[model samples]
Target chain A: MAGDGTGGGSQVVLVTGGYDHTIKLWQAHSGVCLRTMQHPDSQVNGLEISPNGQMVAACGYQHIRMYDLASANPDPVITFEGITKNVSRVGFQKNGSWMYTGGEDCTARIWDPRAPPQTRCQKIFQVQAPVNAVMLHPDQSQIMVGDQSGIIHMWDLKTDQNDQLVPEAEASIQDIAIDPAGKMMAAVNNKGNCYVWALGGQAHPVPRKHIAAHHKYALRCKFSRDSTMLVTTSGDCSAKVWRTSDWTPMRELRHETQRWVWDAAFSIDSRFLFTGSSDSYARLWDVERGTLEREYCGHQKAITALAFKDQAV
Target chain B: MEVRPPEKQKSLLAEQLENCPNLPHRQYLEYAKFDGTAQMGLPTKSFKIFMTMLPEKHQNYPLVVCVIANAKIKDLIGFTCYKYSIEHPEISLGSVHDYGLCIAEDDGEVDWAFPCLDSNEPCSKFGFTCLGLIELKYKTVCAAPIPMPEDGIAFHMFPKAADSGQSHQNTSRHNTGGSQTSEAVISAIRAVNEDKKKSGDVNLEKIQSHIMATEAPQYKVYKVYLLRKVRTNTPVQLGVSLDRIEVEPLVTHKHAFWQSRSKYFLHSIDSVAWCQVLETRGNRTTFRIIYSPSHNAAYSDKNISGNTSFFHPNSTYKVHDFECEHDMAKEIVEKVNTILDLRNSPCRREYKTAKEKKSQTRRSFHTKHLS
Candidate 1:
């Protein structure tokens, strides 16, 4: 397994973090652990790789830590603290100018990495309840923040206008995702339902359809880079791949001891899925065949959050 | 295993079975009840509700004559015959649990020695003695066999040893209660058959109708419910009719039979108070008949041989209450209401005709609204 961009055939970095309070970088294809970084204080809630592929940011209780992907440092290169509660998700802008994070503190914060540590938080978009997910639009102006109160707050950074939509009553929005084409956006709730909306304008979310994707709590939903498929992992212990064209199920990837699959990431080609589950192993599954391709087995506890990037460098 | 043939039916039973297609069932239905004119005006003291305790209680009563009615009665006659000769250990759970009326006796005799209360003077005055049981081989009452009630009063009649004179002589001498009791019922039926052969009066209905007309019991107990008195927690039969309420101790023991029932006329009842057992958490419906036993002699019925009082009938007011399971309580109320309608009253008939017309219109309006 190669390190990062400079010395790689195909730069593929898979980082998983969980309640064990450690971040593990695995060889996505060979199932080897190339590095383990200590998260130090709390369990990691979410993880995302920067668009430049040089850094990976992990959000946890009261902190968001960015680790240097090019170096062998076992500690976070920079730790941003003073967040009041557990941060749920972290993502970067398409140009990597800023970072966005949603947290149990009921706010989504925009942080500029170049700014001084004390003044890094550039903006705060507050909602009625703790935000569980935040997704950046392809245009990079509209930020969709899904919260515990079932409201999806679409905050347009360009005009500072906010719009809210509730997909279900009394169901907490667990995760939200937008296709790379920017045409479709889907949000999954704790009730195992996935709601799809046709995105025309920045805030106009037309209800498309409802799909019952799982029988239990759905944890994470992500769209393939090609915008052809969607993979949703759930507490039902299976990550399901559904074709976006007809919204039909393609396959269900399940392992004997998978337990609750907390997070999943799609391969760039959409042929495979990497799932982190409560069984302390991040599994690579062939999306079409629904077979176990490999198991990344070094985590001591649950591998709750994972970030994957496979790109030609 | 030896291959044996099915026992040959006596020629007379086969002939009767051939004559009457439903002879076995007819015999069962006809003979099972002893609540007819045959029981009327008789020494009711000599009668026991429990057929199994016949030998112990009504030893002097002519059990054979009354029991000649049907197959079930023939089985009861076996009970009386056993009274004449042998003691019974076989009279067990069936007779005791169902209170004699619904005896379910199996084929074999059972001899069990249980400790009896020898004396009440000492707490430990207990003695073990054998409960004697006699073996009975039931002969088919008819050639065309019939299915009887599943758990009703059914027992095998002792074999008559009709083919073997020697065995018949021994059965009568030792009187194992085997032959003598059944002989009377069989002979009477044979007499009926003999009369049928001569006169062509082959119908059993004629005989039954005659009995029903002439034999209304002292208390024509219409509907009987096996319930327990709420106040005393003792088992009782709440026999209800349109106007008569007979609360008798229904334990089926000699004492329960002798314990005079608390009788009341429904019209004399100030109020019939009953708890809604269907919704009660206790699963028991407490039914009470509160009666102010009127001093008026005009309403008294002269069926009882002498004056009988229940909960002091002479008292200004009395409440007779009993409790039963919810289903049984519902059944009792439903049956009582049905019997109340069975009473012939010209005034009530006219009122019911008018009420039906009103209800019919109400029902039609509701249906129209629902549609």
Candidate 2:
């Protein structure tokens, strides 16, 4: 990790962004913001901390910006432009060799981030509707892309083959997640429903469970690092944790002023979770106790995306 | 190169045509081109556009929105009040041209005028604006109460696979004692008859009437919403009457005196009915109301006077009951209304007549309102 400290395995880093047009890095344990980077171009659409913890990638309207984590630079070290619409989601491959993004342009793209002057989007997978979320499985072979047409497209990177599934015809797929173990996958949609599938040795994912996770539109779903729990956030102003064993609700994390929760991330230990909400605050909660543990308050507006990396467990 | 079957080739061509059509029409109803008015309103200032679905039951649900932003002041103007059908999600937003709400400026001066969020229809694609400029955007994460109540009970019945098997469990709630009162039983019977019709099956009214005829005379007062299929602005008053299990609509007929005696019959004049789900197939679900009119008969020794007509025909009205799947059935039921005004109900008059009889006989008497 290329941060301020020497090679320490126990070092932790947290980053978040939103409508305030700024990205803030935090000390995960202390909740103190260490640095603030101005993202004045557009409100942050998605955020991802690099696998090695040396950089941060923030996707916005039409640009994907990369900032060096160790440097106090006020400007992005690399910026990829010319995207036709909002770049809704961005994430790095496990080895940080390339980056993947889904956007309103109805495409999920692979970009060669290592290309310094020109970040060339290497490949594009077109779909029928605007793309909302993109996730790479832990196996590092399949990319899951979800779109506003309520379709989830699975692209096999090795074979260059793809398949699609429409969980609900009328609901737009908002977010998707796969467990760290790569044994299961969960997706939440605009209709407040969550669908889970069991991943096997074969290519086809078996349908496991369907949960009505919220009353209104569901914005995000994430699996805990340990894979024992899943969390879904919605417009109803609450985040619910579900046990992976039975898919039953575990706890409801709610705050009076938290209008809409936009994003969430699990700590490396899977014992804690951090959420960014439209209430303009990033909150940490003990997943087991379902209690608010800490609040990282600095953004002047709603926090739309967040990323966290903790000491390797 | 690989060889393919003729059918496969045809399907591949069809898919290509679907993706690269020469002509295209609007796929979504909420399409509105941003005419640079929003850009001009706040050319330099940046503001976040946060959106959340207004709960269905909220009284101030905005249907037709007229967002007036002060371009010069760079401030938001609040939404206005209006009436709209929450049921119309597929309708185009531009179809309705009313922006009736007034923007009440609070606490200060204002400048330029601009409209935003004016689309009355629901949208699937919340497009993003340019990089770093004050542009329209969608919130990425949403928070809510866990196990959202609106998540609508998994209703696990996927029409085809579970069509006949164990699907009875879905109707178990209607059979429970709490929901099986006379009114519910009547509506249930009617609903079954209508459900049968949708499946293109014969009406079950014959079997229903037979079952109702076998039951002993156990008349009970039942209260039900009477939605009249007429040109009335509102539903009639809640109907309180003797309930029967028959699936036939109540028909009332008025006639003159006969054989020096009085007579009245149930004819298809105006009666109240209750709404219930009738069928669900693919994306469509149908609802229906069964109309049953009550009859008041009188008799004398000179000659029995009353019209006894069996197998009278009653009408059934159907409506589309499908909304977004997340919405509960209860929400659909709430939209069905009462047709009669409460002031016109016969309960007060019946009480007066019963009171006069009690005064003459000096006996303890009681009256009950089913609702």
iRMSD values, candidates in order: 46.4, 25.1
TM-score of chain B of each: 0.24, 0.15
CAPRI quality band, candidate 1: incorrect
Clash totals in order: 1, 32
| lDDT of candidate 2 over A28-125, digit per residue (tens) | 54343556676866999999988888888999998899987777554576778779899999999988999999999999999997653343778889
Those runs of model 2 whose alpha carbons end farther than 4 Å from true positions after fitting are A1-10, A116-119, B1-371
Clashing pairs in 1: B37-B215
Tens digits of lDDT, candidate 2, B1-371: 12121121122212211222111011111111110111112221112221112222331212222122222111121111101111221111111122111121221111113233334422212221111111122111222222212312321211112112221122211121111112322333344345436544454754443333222122222222233345322211222212212122123233422323222112221232444565555644444433333321111122122323223443322221222222222323322211111111232223323444556345222211221
Please give the DockQ score of every candidate, comma-separated. Answer: 0.00, 0.01
TM-scores of the models, in the order given: 0.45, 0.46
lDDT of 1 by residue, B73-115 (tens): 2344333333322122122212111121221212111222222
Report, to 2 decimal places, the DockQ of model 2.
0.01
DockQ, model 1, C-alpha based: 0.00
